[model samples]
Every structure is written in structure tokens, then in C-alpha cells.
Target: MTQERISLFVDHIGPFDAQKIGVLRGKANSGLELLNGHNIEVVQGFACEFDRLERFGFSPGAKIGSDFGDLDMALVQITRSKVETKLLVAQAWDATRVGGRIVVDGQKTDGIESIYKALRKLGIEPDTLVKSHGRIFWFERDETRPFADWLEPKLKMPDGFATAPGVFSAEKLDKGSLALIAALPPLAGHGADIGAGWGFLSRAALGHEKVTKLDLIEAEIAALDAARVNIIDERANFEWADVTKTSGRFYDFIIANPPFHTERTANTDLGVAFLTTAARNLKPKGQFYCVANRHLPYEVVLNELFRNVAEIGGTSAFKVFQAAQPRRL
Candidate 1:
């Protein structure tokens, strides 16, 4: 098939994704190479995963898009969450043109079979294949269903801020962040909020007039979109970027309440990488402030990145740290 005749959707691209895509394409005798210049669309909300896809030569089709409404075919790599998985299937179904296919693959442990049952309820009986401790299923789109409810809603957060599902702390403001704000000292010059979620911390930093500028850096597009509405100051800039790969020595101060969990598993490396990024982005003698769960071992990571690190505030469940004089690596 010619490039103009084909459109592909691959979400959260990773090592095994290419093979899955090839398998799906082969079933249709599409004769498409990975680099065949097809209309390849990758939907990823996280900056780190998007960067990984770029390294694999799938640098998005036309800017970063979360909605998949204009595609011929879609391949979704399902997540473990029931809510997220249902949303993906709904979007894939809505995006695929009539007669086009929606291909889904995921591990059994991630609830793939449950999703299969859900698809059946939508009148889609997919051709299924099982391998690699997972299942791959595909079905042609003929009649679409009303799936508006599956779309994430703009739920109200504290102080009238808006947030949606899939974003961290969706239901309320984070207590650790509130503690960090209380302990935070006056900050001057430009600053960046490394994992700014819905602009809570960034908005708090703006209370001090000395903070001439602030950047709300977030990985998820949904969170950043809400942040734009919450933080109205011209000094506040929104960046949909991965903190670890974010560049520039522009900030005099940095703040974050870094995420340490991936799915249900604890991953301290994520928080460590955020600390290193904060250190690298700050100017000489610049300071970094962050809050962490009391039990997390971030002290060692902070000590390795900064000239001096000290605890500024703490509750029984959370601790705030102030690190100064970022050590040049």
C-alpha cells in the first residue's frame, strides 16, 4: 500500500511496539516498512516517552496531539488502569474510519482480557492472537458508539483549578506540596517548577514579588493545559516538556515534588532524575526546594547533586529539603 493510503497509531512507543505494529500491518498485507513514510501518529502524554519515540524516528505527525480523531487505523498499547484502558479503546474506536481496524495489545496481567470483554459490549468482536504473555486483538470499525462519557472530564481542583484523570493528584491538592510551600523562603529572579501539576506550586511561588518570572514545566499535556487556565500571570510560562531532557541554564531557583512511582511500582530513579535535572538547570549559587515522602531516600540524591542540602521543614508523612550551590558535574 502507498503511504497516502495508510495511517498508523502507536501509543507509548517502546522496544516491543515496532514488532506489534509490523504484525498488525502484515495481517492486512500492507507491505509497509517502519520508515515507509506512512502517516504514523504516536500519542503519548509523557515527555520522556515521547522523546523515546523520537529516537525511534516517530517524532509525532503534526505537533503533539492527544486526540486521535483523524486516523485510518490505530494500535493502542493498553495500560494497567481500567479507566485509562477504557478511554484508549474509546478514542481508538472513534478515530478509526469505517472499515479501518483498531488493534490493541497488552499483557494479561494488565487486564487485557477485561478490555476484550468491554470491546464485545461495543459490538466489536476482534480477531485475537495470543503470545508473549499477552494478547493482540483487532476489529474493523463499522458502527460507532457514543463514548463521550469515557473522555476525561475537567474536574475542579482546589482554588478553582482544573484537572483531569491520568494527571497526578487529580482529586485534590497534594499535602506534601502544601508543606513545601509553607516552608519555602522568598525566591528571586526567574524560576521553574519542574513537575508543576495544575500550577499549584507555581502559583504559590508568584505570591512573592521577588519572583520576577516562573515556568511551569510539566510532562502531561492535560495538566499543562489546565495550568494555563489556573496561572494567569504573564510571568508564568507553560512548557509541555520532560524535566530530565529539558535544557538551558535559565532559572535562578527550581522547585518540584517529583513523581516516584510508575504504575503501582516504586521507582526512586524517577525522582533522582528530577533532582539531577533541577541541579543542571539552575544557575551557580541558585537554590532548589522540593518535598518528598518521608520514607523516600532522596537525601542521598540531593547531596550528590548540590553543594549543601538541608531539611527545611517536615511533617510526619512529608519532608521538605532546601539545596543550595548546585555542584557542577
Candidate 2:
């Protein structure tokens, strides 16, 4: 079906880029670009848990998922929740410059129908379209104030708190991560927590007598915030980064409940990357430990990366493993 609107308005800020906000997030890296003669801020997060996006100034860290660099319209991709869908739609509705538009996209399984239903509930009409079984909808509204202006005045993104519609663990704890925390050994000296979602494992590691210094590495900005709060201590160091992209000092011990999927699709490559990186980034004679879905094909990478790999434990939803390296970090 033809869409009623073609775009959505959003906070134009994230990852420092010369490209306009649209390009920064959706397009490629690097370019001289902006909007309305103003440099747009393009911000992004995998799984929609981003919260640091609120800080003002030139952001050099927002990872771009879609290039929204030069569109007169705004677009918000919600992969997690319908409430968030409503929030985004409401914001888009109130932000458009009369005749401007906004669009929302989501997988049908992710509750796209519910979002469409909610829009109808709001009396705001949408022109619907479909893609790969996913749904996309658009709407237009009259002149409205800056959308953020209508949100609670003086609202601030809380530390350790970042969220977006439909992102896993956006509202609270990640159950798998929590289980991993309950299983971790006491940490010591310096350690790194791989795929440390929202800093849960890293925080648990902090209770150990060792772990004088802890590196909490996560790819999502919002999760980094959670790690920051949960690991609030002088020894904690937070890195908002992809674990596989790490370039840093090796550690005495490394722990993780490595991410295994992007949405629902099983992505063994991500686990392999984590395992390989854990091996590469661990200190010689140190240990690398992780928890994973029992069904993931991670043994090959684990065997290749460590001097020794052993199954430590598991549950219906997870499996735990421990690895050690004889090679120098």
C-alpha cells in the first residue's frame, strides 16, 4: 500500500561524522554533511539499548545502522516493543513540520501489527507497506514543536539506563546474563568481561577479592551505561565497543556470556568472533570463560582459540565452558 508519510523526525545526534545524521547511521562512514545548515547528530545502538545518546556535543561513538543524514523526514527503527512503537509514533507525530512525515519499520513477529493497531487507536492514520514479511507504516501531521520538547521537561537519561522499543533487556536485567553472574568464579587482579551486557557479569566479578581492575566491554552504548552503574567502582573501566574489534592489553582472566544471535537468527559467527577474540585478548596462562546456548556450534572456535577447552556446566537454556591459553597474550 502507498504510505501516507515518508519519514520520521528524531534527535539528530550520534557518532561523530561529517555526514548528515541519516548517512551517519544508515549509510557509510565518513563524509561532510548536515541538515538545515546544521550538523545532524546520528546515533545508533544494536538492540536499541542506547542511552548515552542524550549527552550533547560532538559524539564520535554513535554507531550508524541506517543513514538518516539528509532526509527532510525522520525514521525510527523499532525491533523490540509496541510501547516503544507508540512512543516513537507519538514523538514523530508531534515533531513533524506540517506536511512532513515519519515512518516505523519492524518485523511482523516483533509485533508490527500491534504498532499498526495502536496508531489506529491514536486516531492517527498510517499508510501501510510490507517488506520481507516485516511491516512499515507512515503518517503525516501538522506543524508541531520540537518532539523532545513535549517529553517530560528536565528529563535526563539515567546512568546505567538506556532503552528503545523492542531491544532485548531494554527495561531491565537480561536473564541469561544474570545466570552467568551467579555462576562466575571470584575475580582477581585485572579482568575483562566479554559481551558484558549491561555490565551484569562485570558487576558480579567486582565482588571478588581480586579484579583490582575490570574492563567491561560491550558493543551497545545503552548496555555500557548499565555496566557503568552496576560496576560503579574505581577499578571499573567501561568500553562501548564490539568485543571482536578490541585492541587493548590482555587480562589475567576474561569472562563472558557471548552474544549468539542477531534478533532470532542463530549467528554462530558472532560467538566464534567472541571466542577468537577472547583467546587473542587474554593473558598467557590465564583463563577465558563463557556461557552460551547449548545448541550453538561454538566448539570449533573454542578449540581453535584456547590451549584447552572444557565444559564446566550448563542448564536447559545455557552451557558454561572454561578455556585456558598457554600462549602469551
Candidate 3:
């Protein structure tokens, strides 16, 4: 559905005469080929999308840095967060050259209509085309940068953690993670926190006096950046990696609050993949601690992968598990 919307928008406005084009928040299958003959630069933060784009021979970046400010055209892909979508639009405007075109595309479910209305409210009327249950709007950048202020709002949590608009649990510590932290036993030696968002779980894990080192593995660059800021301890090692994929290192212990959704709908397969990776990356005697929603069917996989699995603790909304002695594949 996201690919179809991007293709429809690209097909609607093609054969561009621009020399350079910028795509913000693009995914792996974002139909980037439609602009084949142009010098394209993608701004994608998610590690999965960034790795996929790199594998496909595109030089994609994780952030819209200051060096990417002279594009002849810029495209903004709307995300689930309205504030993040608006921030991408502001970035598109900032990256495009004066008099250059800035295009925004998103599904109706992603609040495309709201963005259109908000743009109009800012005194900038954009030419729009509606199709594929989405909208593609474009406007030329002018000398007056009305969206400048939109880029200045940074979300700082009450605990002084710096999070961005689109990062998971940006506003506060996730309840499931909190539950996992509460249930965590004193960890020691080299351990890993899979899908560690903003370093909350890793920070909690590091509270144990015996814990020598904790790797905070996160897939989102934005969240990893926050983790870098939130966790300043020398014992915390940060890694930008997809938790679903296998890593070479074996850990003494592993903790996770695996994400269950990649899109609007819940995907149990993602959590399953995380479990698979955890099993694969654990030492034979390593322990794995995880927390998930109570309704999620993680117990079966946990039992299949570990010799012993038990519900350590949790509330009605979440469940914390402890699994030891991973089965060798």
C-alpha cells in the first residue's frame, strides 16, 4: 500500500528536469526507480530501510544533515506521527533550493489531509493530486521560510532524555519496558538489550553492580541517537542494528522489549524474528529476559528455543519472561 501510494505520486509527477532530488523518510520499496535518471539522495533513519537502500545501490543517509541543503527537488514521505510528518516537510523545504519544488505524499490514514490543511493554514498553498487513497502535494520554495520554526521543536522528557518526534516511546518510558526493568534480575558480564529504545532498558540493566557491559542494540537511528545521549556511562555500548537479524557475538544475558508492529497492523512474525535472533545470539548457558503484551503468543516460541522458560513477573497488560539454556540449532 505504501509502495502503491509512492508509485502513484511519482507517476503523477514525472519526467522532472531537476538535477538533484531528495527523498525523506523513504522505505525499502518506495518505488525509487521512478526517478532513475536523477541524482537522488534518500534521508532514512530506520536501520532496516537504510540497509536495504544501501544494498540496492542507493547512497542513503540516516539524517537530513546540513550538507543536503541544495537539492533541486525534495520529497517528503509522511510517517504515522503527524508531528514527525510535519518535521519531514520542514526538512524537505529546508533541503530544496530557493524556487525548487517540494513534494509531500502520504496515505489518508497517515493524516495526509491534515498536513494539507496545515500547510494552507501556514499561508502556503500547494498544488495537490489525490489518488490511491492518498494525496501528493507540491509547492515551490520561496525566500520566506515559513516552516523554519517547525524544525525547532525538540521533545525533551521530564527525565531529561532527548527524544525525537517519531521514535518509539518518545514521550515517556514504555510500560512494557518498565515492567521488564522491574522484573530484571541482577545481570553480570557482557549482556545485550535488543531493540533497546532510548537506552531505558539498558540503563536499568546497568544499575546492577555486577553488570560489566551492556550493549544497547536499536534499529532506529533517531532512537539510537537518543540512547547515546541518555546513556553516558562507559559500560554502555551502543549499536545500530536490526534485532531480527543474527549477530556474531554471544552474550552472557540478553534483555528485550521486542517491537510487534512495523506498520499499522500488529505482526507477530516480527516478535518471533526477534526471539529467533535472541536464541541464535545467546550462549548455551545464557539467559534471556523479555517482556511483551500478555496476549502475544511468545511462549510457544520461547519454549521451542529455550530448554526452560517461565513467566517471571508482569501485570495484566504485560508479561515478563525468563528463558535459559538455548537449544542449539
Candidate 4:
């Protein structure tokens, strides 16, 4: 029996994902090592894929890629979020030769099944289907063809706040963020709005006279880009990063209304990871504050992670927690 050809793989493919340090590293390592044995060259991200290869530990030495060479097979895996799967299908249809295969893996909760059905609309329904935690759909892709942008119509908007479709609270004023802005102490010194979706907390953070710098860290590309327009001052810094896995110099004050749920799952508290990571990014004795829903047990997460945790304020629907890192020994 002959050995099966190893396929090009990416742990994820999404715009604005600041997930450089997650399962992606393992996928990159395996994919790159296998590619070295074959004559195949892999292109990961369409425009900026090469720049990230070595930037995050994906590939040791890969430059940004602009074009696609001949590809025999491609595999992409996404977690609990659905992306424009048709876009991937369209890109594969155009780039792959007639006999090439394009495999997509994503969780059922993330709408992976819908993406599989969408393939039929493009005349590329799966020839292979495997189901488990999610579904794996693979199909033969016909040579390259023009495709529509599925995300084009989902525009997000609010007066004075920048937002994009699918981003958290992009449609209206977020209650917790509004409450934090109101409850915030006469904030002073350099600060940041971790996970600054659509520049809501960022704008409020920068508006304070005490804040000399407002570093906005957001993972979503569209949301991060939206943040840039609202924050035009010299003190503004816009970075794309998964706040949970982000690293940087310390700030005097940090504020957020961290995410507590996704895909119908409640109290996931991945925000706890953010709280810990944000603690490291703050100067010793730096202040930390955020708003969350009423029922979530974030206090346990905070108490276990931070030196101190206190409920500064709450309403019927939401509550705010103020925390601080201990002075280093």
C-alpha cells in the first residue's frame, strides 16, 4: 500500500483572530515538517499568511505570500465560530486543479453544517462527511472561479461607535460597558481597553484627562480596524491580538467588558484567561476593572487569580468587578 499524501493544513483561517498561541502552533509544526519531505510549498493566509508563519511560531522562516501555487489538497479547522465557509470554498474552487480536494472542519455549534450545505449552493457539495464533535466535509474543487463576499451585507453600526457584523455588542450600546464608563473612577495614567470591540471602552478610556495613552487590544480584524478611525489621537495604539494570549508592557489602568458566552454556551469565562493575561500586562499595583452579567461566578475566577477582587457596582442585569495585581516581591 502506498502512503497517503500529506495535505496543507491550518488550525484556523479567520480575519481578526488574535489567536497566535493556541492549537495553531501544533498544526503549523506538523504541516511544515511534512511539507519539507514533499516538493509542495504551502501558502497559509491569503495576503499576510507568510508574515505570520514565523511571527507566531507557525513556520521558522516564511515570508508573506501574495500568490497561490498549484495545490493538491488543503485542510482548515475552526472552533466554535462559523466563518464565511463559502469564501473558502470559492477560493479553493478557483485555486485548486480539477482533481484537488478542499477539507473544512468546524464544530456543529459553530455552523459547520450550514457551511457544508452552502457548498451545494456553489456546486461543490462534500463527497466525504465525518461527524463527531463537529463535521468534516471534503469535496473535489473545480479550478478557480469568482466568488461573492458573504460578509458584505452584515454591517454593524451605532452613533459614535465603530462596529462590524458578528462582533459582540456591535448593534447597540452595551449595558455593561456603559455602566463601567459611568462607574469608572476619575481615571488617570496610561491605560488600555482589553478586547475593545468597536472602540467603545477605548474611546471612553482615551477621553479621560488622566490617561496619557490608550492602548486598544482587539482580536477581530474588522473591529480592530474600526477602532483605528475612532481613536485618532497621538496617545492611541491599536493592536490585533487575542487578549487572552497577548503580551506587552504594563499599564496603570485596564478596563473591559469581557466576553462570558459564545455559541449558546453560558459562563465559559474564557475571560478568566484574559483577566490573568491582562494581569501580567499591567504594572505592579495596576488597577483592573470589567463588567459582566449578573449570574456569572467571575468572583471565584478573579479571587483565585488576582490579589484582590471587589464588586464596585451592579444593576439588575450586570455587575462590575474592580481588581488589582499585587506589588511584586
Best by lDDT: 3
The models' CA-based lDDT, in order, is 0.74, 0.60, 0.87, 0.62
Please report the TM-score between candidate 4 and the true structure.
0.70
List pairs with backbone clashes in candidate 3: none
Residue 51 accuracy (lDDT) in model 4: 44
Residue-wise lDDT of candidate 2 within 1-329, one digit each (tens)? Answer: 11211121122223222222231122112121223354444445642223333332334336433333234455555545555455555544553345655666666776778877866765667776665656766666555443443233232333445443333566666666666666666667888887776665676788887778988877766567656665669988887766787755678998888777765787887788887788787778778878888778677677777769888767788778888873433
RMSD of each: 6.6, 7.8, 1.6, 7.3
Residue range 1-329, candidate 4, lDDT tens digits:
00021231232221221111111111343334433433343333211333455564444212113344345655544433344344444544455556666666666776777777776776665754444546666666554453556534444467756665456776788888888888788778888888887798888777888788888887665677778876788988887666777766778988988887654776555777777766777888789988988887788877776788888987889998888874342
Clashing pairs in 1: none
Q: Runs in model 3 with CA error above 4 Å? A: 2-14, 154-158
Greater-lDDT candidate between 1 and 2: 1
Minimum summed lDDT over a 10-residue window in model 1 is located at: 19-28
Rank candidates, TM-score, best first.
3, 1, 2, 4
Query: Per-candidate TM vs. native?
Result: 0.81, 0.72, 0.96, 0.70
For residues 1-329, write the lDDT of model 3, one tens digit per residue: 55676667677776668899999987666677777889888989888888999888888988877788898999888898888988888888888889899988888988999999999999988988777888888999988879887887666584777787888888877889889888988899999999987888888888898999998888898889989988889999888887777578799999999999876889999999989889988988999999999999999999999999999999999999999999887
Worst 10 residues of 2 by lDDT: 1-10
Comparison by TM-score, 1 against 4, better one: 1
Q: Which candidate number has the best TM-score?
A: 3
**Best first by lDDT, ranked:** 3, 1, 4, 2
Q: Kindly report the root-mean-square deviation of model 4 from the true structure over all alpha carbons.
A: 7.3
